[model samples]
Each structure stands twice: as structure tokens, then as C-alpha cells.
Target: MFTSPFQDYVIDAAQRTVLFWDVMRARGNQYVEHTAQDAPHVLSYDFEPVMAGTDLPSPVNYGLVRIEPPKGVKVDEAKRPFVIIDPRAGHGPGIGGFKADSEIGVAMNAGHPCYFVGFLPDPVPGQTIEDIMKAEVAFIEKVAELHPDASGKPTIVGNCQAGWAAMMLASYRPDLCGPIIVAGSPLSYWAGVHGKNPMRYTGGLLGGTWLTALTGDLGAGKFDGAWLVSNFEGMNPANTHWSKKYNVYKNVDTESERFLGFEKWWSGHILLNAEEMQWIVDNLFVGNRLPTAEVETTDGVRLDFRNIRSPIICFCSHGDDITPPQQALGWILDLYADVQDIRACGQTIVYAVHPSVGHLGIFVSGGVAKKEHREFASNIDLIDCLPPGLYEAVLTEKTEDTPDADLVATDYIARFETRTLEDIRALGTNSEEDERRFATAARVSDVNKGLYQTFAQPWVKTLITEEQADLMMKIHPARLEYTMFSDKNPVMGVVKSMAKIVRSNRKPVERDNPFLVAQEQMSDMIIRSLDNYRDMRDNAIEALFLSIYANPLLQATVGLSADEKPPRARPGRSPEHIELVKRKVEDLKARISHGGVREACIRAMIYIGQPDSAADERRFEFIRSLRKGVPGELEAFKLTVREQFFMLLIDESAAIAALPDLLKGHADEIEQGIAFVRQVASTGGEPSDAVKERLSEIEKVFNTALCTKR
Candidate 1:
């Protein structure tokens, strides 16, 4: 207390210096270790390759690998297998299962066989995106062959970039896919709102994908993924420059392992072939063609999202700036005219929107994996049972005292609430003006890309060399940051040596230490400043993009018609489609008088239940237990019930009129069915008056049928 301020200042400064040096040494060690481990490929999962894409006729660097189940977990070969495809945007594979609490882990824990679609660091020479898609199809076929006892096709989970890839595969070969979960995947490329998403404007502002071609050419036909990683980091400067490093420094002693482990995956950049990169940019990114069915494979077959027969589940987050809820959910609006159109196409689309979670967090966060993914994995059968329509999978936390809590294995309850196209629009930033602007951008991109390809590509390709390209990649700003502070740098050798001494004689600061508190305040100030700068820069970019692309003159110059509206819906169904739907409806009507008490009861319940409401896990568990007690073939009965329920939803009055035939003379079965319906309806709370009325009406129908039998 009696000490001079200068002495106190000197002591605090010395402690800070020691801590700083130690942090630098730890970072250097991490950098060196990560580099060594990442030189080949970085995958958190321990996997053995089942098949390599190179072994196929159309070779690719991709591979199919089965994930080894964690200790105490056993795979169920009879259960539907899960194939998780991680985003290969910039970082290496395994983010989908980087930890035990991840997508793959959740599937494995649920006793399902799991596989991963990962790629080598180097792209196969002369490989295209089409080849990769083919390889993925082959991988899925192999997995299917391996699990002959599996009840259904493999469930594929696609994260971010891989989400679109999986969709392509599903669209091309619908027979091979089952239920597909596309989380944080942007199908609608140009579908972001102003002020919130600046990345969408990047392609337009940079004048289309010509720059992409140029960059790839300069890289000796290999697009360096570090550039993509840099773009991601640029989106959050505070985290990139301050928070990420400060987190490790502040908790260096305990945080080293976790931080290093994550960085190993984050820093392991991959590569893409020039042709693959250009095709993605030209067809998907700037052109926005995937949802429109304009993208064609090398074999001239078109990719149509409507062709996918598997039930599609889209998992997105409102808080994800990279793939916002609009980008994730807008394709439904674009491809189908309305919810009725979805039903007519016989597609079951389920979507879940988390209130807050980043893009990566959607796939990798432990909390998400536990709640959303666990619920999804456990209730795949329930989802499969749902009628052909749009629905939202809602998850709510289960309280300790909640009814049937002991009977449920998970902590969250899962429910599927029927949703409408309007409900989906509510999740998006649906501005007609924004749509028109993006359409114009797409047109302009076509012009700019053609001009570049015709005039500039050949010259650029001729001047680039392998050695120069490798040097350029090595010196990329993102890679340099890591290399500059590693053992490769002589200046860091002293830091490593000094850090060992500091570690042995560590003098940790207290939480209330004045100097440490002040340091934190300074760090926060820096982060705030960086955030402010980022906001300003993003706003400016947005303003500049609109000023250039929204010009009427530019629209005319790009050959876009002046009075054209955005193409929001797919073209009307052809005559063949109309005839097919009519025939199917006729067939369903003919079969309406076909089943017994179980079918009639399930159909009537689906008819009367409120579409706005959802059933909890307890309800699903009760159903499962009820199924076990029933006297019929379980799987076949379930399928019949689902099909009958779907027919009822399509034509309520016709389906209800035929119910008497279905339940004729089965008085005891009718009573049992009513009790089961009541149990399901009353799981969350008391049944509504509407439900009670519906139950009464169903009872009256059964009574009438019994009297007729008499």
C-alpha cells in the first residue's frame, strides 16, 4: 500500500511482458504443429476409406469413409444409414464431426451406421464438379449395397457448400436418396436482403465470375482455398484480429488444447480445380441457376429440384449471416407456385429455423447437435410418416417435471407443425424489388463472363507457371500470418525458448487484478472499433453495389428487358403432369374403401388435427409403445396409415365419406383406435374443443357403420 505508483507500474508491465511472450510461444508451437499435421489432410474423425473416387471411371479426389463409432456406441445395420457431407468451402473436412457432440456423433449415438464424403487436399487433375457429383452418387450406392438390411435409403446430411452438392445428387438420382437434411445451405444464391447480407453482392460488384477464372488461372488451374478462408475472416474482423487470439491469451494455460485443435481444421486449406470453381460461380453463385433448373451436367441432363423424391428437411438459423433463413428457405417459393403445388408434386418438405445460431454452429455446435439433430435423428420415422406437405420441425426444452419425462431419452421434445408458403415467406426478406435487382445482376454476370472468356482467359492461362503459382499460394496473406509466427521464422526461436522458462515460473494474475482488468477494457475497445469499421465498410459496399447494378442503363446494356418481372414460379405443369396427377387422385379414390379400423382411425385423426400444432417427443414415444402393443404387421401398417392420411389431407370430404367401409363391423377396434387418438392428442395439454368435436364426429361415423352391419 505504501509502494510508489512507478514501482507498481513497473511490476505490472513485467508480468504483462511475461504473459505476452508465453502466449506468442504457445501460438508458434500451435502453428508449427498444425502445419505438420495438416500438410496431408486434416480430419477429426478416425475413418477408413471404403472407396476412393479415383477408382471410378470418372475420377475425382473425393472418397467415401465410414466413421468409426465412439466407444460404448454400437452401429445398427438395420437402421437407416446416415451419410454426412461436410462443406469443403475453404477449410479441410471433419467440421461436421469435429467433436463427440456433432452431427455424425449424434447419428452414431442413435445407433445408425454413419459415413462421410470427404476429399483429398489435391483435386484430381482434369476433374470437374460433375465428376464429383457422380462420385458422390457412387458413394451413396456403395453405402446402400453395404447395408442390405437397412429399412430405407441412406439419410444424407449436407452442411453449407455440401448442402447444394447433396441436393444436386438427390435431384439427379432421386431413387438413391432418402430423407435429406440440408443445414445452413444456400439454395437461393441471390436471395438475401439489403443491409444484412453483403456477400451476395460480392459477385455482382466484382463483375461476375471472370475474376474467379482469372484467379484460378493464376494459381496454375488450382483455386487456392485460403482466399475463401480470408473472405470468411473478413466478415468478422473483431473475431479475426482480436477476440480469437485474446481468448487463447487470456486463458492460455487451459485453452491451448481446444484452441489448437480448432485451428488445425480451420487452417488446413484445400484446393478446387479451375473448371470446378468457375462452374460453381457461373452456375450457382452469380447465375443463381440451381433453383431454376437451368444448370446442366456434362451429360446434358438438367438438375431439377422438383425431381427429388426424398423428404427434404432444411435446417437454418435466423442468426446466420452467411446463409440466412431466406437463402435456406426461399427455394420452395421459387420452385413451387404454392403449398398446393408442393402437395401435387408429392414432396414432403420440412424446415426448422433456430432463432439464433451462426452458419457453422448449425452443423457443429454441441447444443444444436443435442437438441435439433438428436430430435431429428430419433424421429426420422415420424417425419417419414407425415403427409406430403410443408411442415416445420419445432423443438422445445423438456422440464424435469414434464409429463412422461422419465419415458423419454432426450432432453428436448420434437414436433412437426404444418406450415404454409406464407409462413415460409414470413421467415424471409421477400422484396420484389430486391428480386428484380438480383435478376438483373445475374444477366449482367452472363455478359461480363462471356466477355472475359472470349477476350482474357487464354492470355492469362498462357503466362502462369507452376512454380510461380505455388509461391503465390504460399505467400497468400492468410497463409503468411501462420508461417510468419512459426518455427520457420528464426525470430520465433527465442520466443519458444523464453516461453519454456516462463511456463515453469508462471505468475498468474488474479481476476480482480487492476492491470488485467484494464487490459480487458482495452481489448474490448479495440474490438468495438474494428466492428464499427466493418459495419461502415459493409454499408459502403452495399451502397456501391446498388448504385452500379441498379442502373437502368446497365440493365439495358446487359440485355435484360425493361418491363420484365422476376421469374418467381416454375412454369405451369405440362399436360402429362396434369394427367398423371388426375390418374393418381382417381387411384387414391378407388382405394379409399380398402383398409380396416387402424387405417380409418389414423386417417380421421390426421383430418381433424390442427395443422398449426405439433406433437412432442412424449407423443411419439407413446405412439411407438402403442405400435408395439398392436396386432398387425408394424411397418406395413405404418405405411398404409401414412398413405391414407395423405389422401385424407388431399380430399377431406371424399376420404371421410368412405370411412364407414374401412371401419365396418369393427366396434371394438373403433373404440381402441379412439383411445389411441385421444392419447396422442392430449400429450402436451388438454385437447381443444375442435379436436373433441372431431373425435365425436368420428365416433358417430363408427356407430353408424356398426348399426348398418347389424
Candidate 2:
């Protein structure tokens, strides 16, 4: 107890040094072992391929596999199937089901049959983006055929890059799709703030798709995904170089497995054909044409997003720098004029925003799986039943006990709240001027692309060989870091032996050790330094982008209008289409008075809950329980209710006026319906003033109807 402070410090420092070396030795061995284990392909699911893309007419290396449910999880084929398409932006597939608490696991545990769309390490010769889309549509069709008795169409979940692919498929072939969940997918590429998101500016700063074409040519027509992975790592230098490794070193004993597991996925890079990569860059990333309906297939099919009829659910996070909420949400603003336009299009759009999860965490985090994914899986049918509108899916933790607590399955409640364009605009920090700058950048990109394709591409392709491309991929910085510490390195042999000895006689310093405290402080300083550099670099890039593209003279030189304005709507719709929509609207209005008690009740409920209503798990459970013995099947009844409710919402005043006729001489039924609605509204907690007012109006409608009947 009376020992000198210097003596304690010396002992702590020596112990930390020993632990640090041991961690390095262990990490070296792990790198070697993970590399060997995943030599061919790394997949988390135990699956059998139902349709291999390589065998299709237009062969690609991707495949559709059915994920075998783990023990204790029974899947009901009669329930809607779930198809999860993992993102293949840079890495190999299977992150969506890499663990038990994942998207696939969540769907399987909820008794739904699950399938996965995954790809191999190499892209097929001459494979294009259109080929991949065709393959995915085939997989979806196969799943639908297999689930003939299912209540509804299969629910497709697409992660990151796959999310946009799913959207394209839904737009092209809406009949074959169901409710689609797109998590961490960027539909609006150029819709980021000035200082916060700098990746959006990279396409502009680098000129454009010209670089993508150059990289592909340098790689002998096969684009290296390592470049994409490197870009992602560069976004967060603190995580890539400091925190990730530091966390493992600090908790080496307990974190070895988790660290190695993730590194395997992170390091498993895949390839894309030059054509595929160029199409993505030209049409999606640099061009920003997907949302505007300006992109078309080779066969002349206009891939308009408005063609999609299935409900769309977008999951994003505010903390996701790669696919920030602005990029994830901006497409809605681009595609629709206003809320009324969305309603007129008859599309139900819902989004959920996580407060602090990163892009990868949106698909792979266990905590996210247990909460958000769980709630989404449980409420798929409810989402399908929601009326055509823009809503935010809000998840709240349950705190107090309620009468229906036992009926609930999860600890959180999922609610839908109405949102508007203004709410979406608030997510970005850009003005009309910023948009004009982006437009100017797009114009510059077009010029650079034209010049490069005509002058540079032929020479670059002529000099590149298959061997040189392979060598370049091998020496990529992201890959070399792992290869340097592998067993093949002669220096790692000694490290392996020393690691074994250290494991045999392991000793750890106490948490309060003086030297350990100093070490943590040093680590924090290093991280902060890297973060500061990143911020400065991003700001500089933004400033340079503005200086080059935002100048009116430069914009005019590039053939852009000098006066800055928001993007104008592209003209493509036929006059016949407008006439058809008018006819449909008149037909919809004519059917406003034709419905039964179930329709009347559900319509009244939606009308009363219109302002903003939140529902807990208990509320959903109660609704399900009330429909136990109603009719042919629960889904059929729910579909009918949804159709009628949507019709009512279209013509609210007329629907309300006609409600008395629908429920004539049924006073007891009307009273029961109001009581049920009140009970459902009370499940979330005490109602807000708006909710109370809506409820009062609903009750007055029924009361007046009863009085008139009497």
C-alpha cells in the first residue's frame, strides 16, 4: 500500500507492453486463419442454390439460394416469403444473414420462409447491369411460384446497393413484387449537405464517370471492388486505422471471434464487369437520373419509379455518412411534387431513421436486428394494410405495463405518423443555389466523360493485360494490409510461436492501471487528430467544388443556365396517360358510397387517426385477436379493409357523409366499433390533444348517425 508511485507506473507499463505484443501476435494468426478459411467464398447461411445466375440465358455469377432455418425456428410456407438481397457494392454477399440476430434470422423466427440472393467472387464475361436485374427478377418470380398458397406476394428486403436494385425491379415489374424494404440505399446520389457529406462531391470533383471507365480499363474490363471498399474506409479514418484495431487490442480475449468474423466479410472483395460499373456510375451516381425517370434500359424501357405500385419502406440512419438520411430520403422530393401527388399516385411510402447507426450497422448490427428488423417482420401485414400516403415508422420502447401486455411479443411499439415534404427538406442543409451547383457539376461531368471516352479509354485499355490487372488487385492497399500479416510472411512464424507462449501464461493489467489510463488518453488524441484532418479535407473539397462549378461564368461555359433554379421536371408523360388518370379518379369517386360494416369501421378508424397516431405491439396484437374467426383468412379480410379505407381517404367528406347509410339501423355495432377504436388508441399511452380531438369528431359522427336512425 505504501509502494512508490514510480514503481507502480513501471510495473503497469511493462505489463501493457507484454499485452500489446500478445495482441499483435494473435491478430497476425487471425489474419492468416481467416484468409485460409474463406479461400473460395465466405457465406453465413447454410443454403442451396435454387437458380444460379451463371446458368441463365445471360449468365452472371449471382444466384438465388434458400436459407435453411436454424433449429427451433419453424417456417410456414403459407405465410409471405422473404427474399433478402445482400449488397454487392464491394464485398461478398451474406451480411444480411451473417448472424442469428439478422435480417434473415428475424424473418425466419417470425415463421416466414426466407431466401437469399448472393453472388460469386467473379463477374461473368460481358455481364451488364441489365443482366443482373433480369436475374434478380427471375429469382423473385421463382420465389413467388414456390409460394403459391401464400397470402400475399413475397416481401423483398434489399440491403444497401441491393436496395436500389430492388427498387428498379419493382419499378420495371411491379406485378411480381410485394412490400419492399430498402435499408441504407441511396436513391438520390447528389442530395447531400455542404460540409457534412463530401462523398457526393467526389463525382463532381473527379470530373465524373470518366474515372470509373478509366479504372475499369486499368483493371482489364473487370472493375476492382477494393477501390470502392477503400473509399468507404477513407470516409472514417479513425475507425479504419485506430478505433477498430484499438478496440480489439483492448479487449483481445473476448473480442477475437467478433473481430475476425467481421474482418472476413470486410476483406472479401468481389468484382463487377466494366459495363455494369459504368452504367451504375453514369445513370445512378454521377448522372442522378434514376429518380427523375430519365434512365432507360437498352431495350427502351423507361425505368420510372412512379411505375412501382408496391408499398416502399426505406430504413436509414442519421449517423450514416455514406448513405445519409438526405440521400436516402431525397428521391421522394425528386419524384413527387407534394403529398397530394404521392396520394394521387396511390403509393404508400414509409421510412424509419435510426438515430446513431452507421451504414453497415443498418444491415449487420445485432441490436438493430432484434429491434427494428423484428418490428418490421412482425408488422409486414400491417404495413401492407396502410393507406396510400407518406408516413414515418416510429419505434418507441415500452415502459409501463398495460392490460394487453401479455399479448404483445416485443419490448417496443411501432407506429406510423404522417409526414410532409417540408419534414423531408429539413433533413438537408442545401438551398436552391446548392442544387444549381450540383447541376453545374453534372454538366461538367458530361463534358469530361465525352473527352475521356474519345481520347483516353482506348489507350488505357490497350496497355492493360489480365496479368497486370491481377497484380494490381493483389497489391491494392486494402488487401495488402491483411496479406502482410498472413502466415506466408516469414516474420509471422515467430509471432505465431510467441502468441502461443503468451496464451499459455496470459496476464492482464488492471483497468485502473496508471499506464493503461495514459494509453487510452493517447488513443483518443490520435483519433481526434484523424477526425480533424478528415473534416478539413472535406471542407476544402466542398469549397473547391463550389469555386469551380458554382461560378456563373463557368456554368455558362458548360452550357448551363446562368440563373440558378431547382431542377425542372422532365417532360415524357403521354397525354393519353393523363386522360386515363382522370377516368380512374372519377371511377374512384363513384365507389365512395359502396361498402359494408367492416369497411365503414376501418374507414372511420383511419379518419379518426389521421392527424398522427402511434400504435404499440399490444394494439396490433389486439387487432389480430379481434380477427380470429372473422372469415376466409386474416389476410383476405385485411386486404378488403385496406382497399375500402384507401377509397374512403380519397374522398373523406363524401365517405363521412355516406357512413350513416352504410351503418343504418346498426346502433349497437357502431357503439362497439367506437369502443374498440378508443381502446386501440389508448394502448400507446394517454392521447394527445390532436388525437383526442379526432376521437371526439369520430364519436360525434357515430352519435349523430345513431340519433338520425332513432
lDDT of each: 0.81, 0.81
Q: Provide the clashing-pair count of each candidate structure.
A: 0, 0
Off by over 4 Å in 1: 1-43, 567-571, 628-638, 665-668, 707-710
Candidate 2: what lDDT? 0.81
Q: Which residue pairs collide in model 1, if any?
A: none
Q: By how many angstroms RMSD does model 2 differ from the true structure?
A: 3.0
Tens digit of lDDT per residue, candidate 2, span 569-591?
Answer: 54345677678768877876787
Candidate 1, residue 1: Cα displacement in angstroms equals 11
